[model samples]
Structures are given as structure tokens and as C-alpha cells.
Target: MRNAEVARQLGVPPGTVSYWLHLDRSRRGECPGRRPPPPCPRCDDTPLDEAAYAYLLGLYLGDGHIIQHSRHRVPSLMITCSEKWPGLIDEAERAMRAVFPQNRTCRVRKTGALNVKVYSKHLWCLFPQHGEGRKHERHIALEPWQQAIVDRYPWGFIRGLIHSDGCRTTNWTTRIVAGERKRYEYPRYFFTNKSDDIRRLLTDTLDKVGVEWRVTRRGNDPYNVSVARREAVALMDRFIGPKL
Candidate 1:
């Protein structure tokens, strides 16, 4: 049966089915396209054929939590394999179609990082802009560590540079340690107050990477890319000492 039909029968979103199918793909030695056969749902451990597996993956890709926003629903397909498997992606696509004939718009992209592939669609939202003269909302107070990142890294590296009206909270602390998962948000301490924790983390990571940086508080305006670039060059000169 197609993914939608299976999802309707199962009383779940098509995307959820897709996620399970994807997980099943990982369990098997095969990439995505080479599904075994549909096992009995009652049995749980029964193998799945290519058609059955594709339907499940379609359900997952459609309903997975990987994307933050719910309005933008797009399916994706990723395939990895050993040897020069140039046909793997194609085979997977065909198999998926056998289950969900309606899913023709999902996008797939290949990355050079190992044998990984990513399938996703963009989600768009409408939000306000932040700048002078605009009514600004107070962002969450930054922890010491987050502040450190802002003080150390150049502004250009920070992702979310624009200001916008919204809620703020301490939950953002994770960004400094790992980084933001979303596309628009800054690294850490962009809108929030500076913290010592951020500074130490920034310094440590930069040190490990062999990049030298400095902190300067010129004004309330956070790190600006052009200004930071100029400052970085000067800092490098100071570090190496005057050239003889």
C-alpha cells in the first residue's frame, strides 16, 4: 500500500511512517532502496520488502521532527553506500515512488562529508526586523559563557545578526556549547546578555583551533562583521609582533 493509505489505516501522519522506514533502512545492511519485504505488523520483527520500506520512509520524511516549523512539510531521501554505487539514489527514488506516488517534490542533496546524503525542504516564516528606531524586545539574559563567545568571535561568524521582536529565555544556553540547529539564529549571546561561560568556551575552542582573538566593547551594538574583520587583522599583527 502507498504511504498515505498506510498512514490513514494506522491513524498516524505519513511522515511518522517515513521515519520508521528510514530507521529500518539503517538496521539492514542495505542502503535505502534495497528493502527486504513487509513483515507482519503484529510480528514487529518481520522483514520488509522494498515497496513496504519505501512507504515507511515516506511517512517519516513527511512527519519527522528534524524540521522545527510544522507549516513547511517536505519529504527528503538520503542514501549512503559502499563502492561506487552511482545507482543507489535512483533505485531508492523508484522504490519510494512505488509506495507514495504523490511525493514527487521532495528534494535530495549530496554532501562530501563521508557517504552521507540529505533530503529536506525549506520552511519559511514571517517575522519582524530588528534595528534602530524599531521597538526591541528584551532578549534572555546571557550566561557568562555565552557572553564570552560574543566577546571573542568575529561578528561575521555569528549567524543571527538581525534584531526582531520575540520571546527570550535561558533555554538558548545550549547554542554556545554545541551551536544553533536553525539557520537564522546567532551562535550565542547575539541578542542575549553576555556571560562568562560563553567567553571561556569561545577562548578554548579558538585556542584549540589555533586562532587568536580579542574582546572589545565599543558600544551596545553587538559585534559588527566589517569592524571585527579589521580588528582581527590588527590583533594578528600584535600577536606576531612588529615585523623586522
Candidate 2:
């Protein structure tokens, strides 16, 4: 049937029906004019930057999402970065490009954040955690292969998480020293996520790296992982620093 007919019957836009038909033909190798998709690291054994992949994975768990619309030919990997930190947007784009060098990436401004996205059919293969419903509502676990990559580049993963949903802030208090009031400040790191599994990933990696962290409650929900120990904060400062 024609796309218009299908669109009318299904109550969808004609363009959507056309896109679906085009995607079906392309998948069957019937669309000779379509550009062939680039090789995938998971399926084609292509070389991948494990460190970058680890970092991208962290950002994904924290603030990233993949869209696979039935009417779209390819899925999009999107990581929402705050416009307040333009540098993070660039870094997120770099990470996406590094993970999929052959694909092009684009940024769409939305309210106060920029959605950094790249289109590729292999996004699901790279990010196996993509699924139905919100990430926090679903069971999230890393496959063995992804775990191996994170294990090798734990700091990179932590940095990615920090850049996405974590922050470095200073806490200050007043103290009496030699009959004079003195102000003292200490810096700490906080990683906040709604998903329990995502928070566990951060703390687990922190443990492997010998960085002490404690779970903190936001109101009634324990949704924050705090790294406030002097030694741990120093360690995090040395590696992750503040998001630019």
C-alpha cells in the first residue's frame, strides 16, 4: 500500500509512514541509494576507545538517552548537557564522536540545556542499557563487556558522571582561632541520580578507586552520593575537578 494510504489508516503522518517504509527497504538491502551504515565495534569488531566508551556510559546512565522511533531509520544517542557549561556540551559531543567516529553529531538547544545527539543504528548495540520506560524505573545493569571497559577506565567513568549529574562545591564554617574568628572552607563532590542502580555504579567504581563515598539523603530519598572526605575530595579534584 502507498504511504498516504497507510498513514490515513494508521492515523500517523504521511512522512512517518514513508520513513518506515524507507527504513524497511534499507534494512533488506533493497535501497541501493542509501549509504551503508558504518561498522559497529560490537558487531564488526571495530576498534573502540574503551576509556571514552566508559565515560560515555557514565554520562548515559546519569543524563543520557537513546531514541529509537519506529518511523526513524536510525536511533539517536542523546546526552543532555547544561547550557551553563558550554564546555561540557563540547566534551559530550567529543565523547559521542569518539565512540562512533563515523557518525555525525548535532546539538539542539532546549530551554537551559543542549541535547547533544548522534544518529546511528548501532546505538543500542553500544549502549545495551537502552530500553522502554524511564531508566530509573527499569532494571539497569552493565553487561560483562561494558563492565570490563569501565573497570579499565574507572576514573574516566567517574569523570563522565561528575560532568553530567555531579558537582564540586565548597562548604564553609566559622571557627575561633587565637581569639579571632576565622573562616574555613572545604570542598566536596556530590553525585545525584534518581536511579538506585545508577548511584550504585558510581559508588562501586569509587570503591575500586579507593575513593571514600557515603550516600546522602535529599529530603526523604537517599539520592545522592557524597565524597566529602578530605582525601577522597582531593583524589576527585585531582582527576574529575569541576565541570567546565
* lDDT (CA) per prediction: 0.34, 0.92
Candidate 2 has what TM-score? Answer: 0.86
**Candidate 2 lDDT, 161-194, residue by residue in tens:** 9998899999889999999999999999999999
Q: What C-alpha lDDT, on a 0 to 100 scale, does residue 86 get in candidate 2?
A: 86
State every prediction's TM-score relative to the real structure: 0.21, 0.86
Q: Which candidate number maximizes TM-score? A: 2
- Local lDDT at 54 for model 1: 26
The pairs that clash in candidate 2 are none
Residue 192 of candidate 1: its Cα lDDT? 26
Q: Global CA lDDT of candidate 1, please?
A: 0.34
Tell me how candidate 2 scores on lDDT. Answer: 0.92
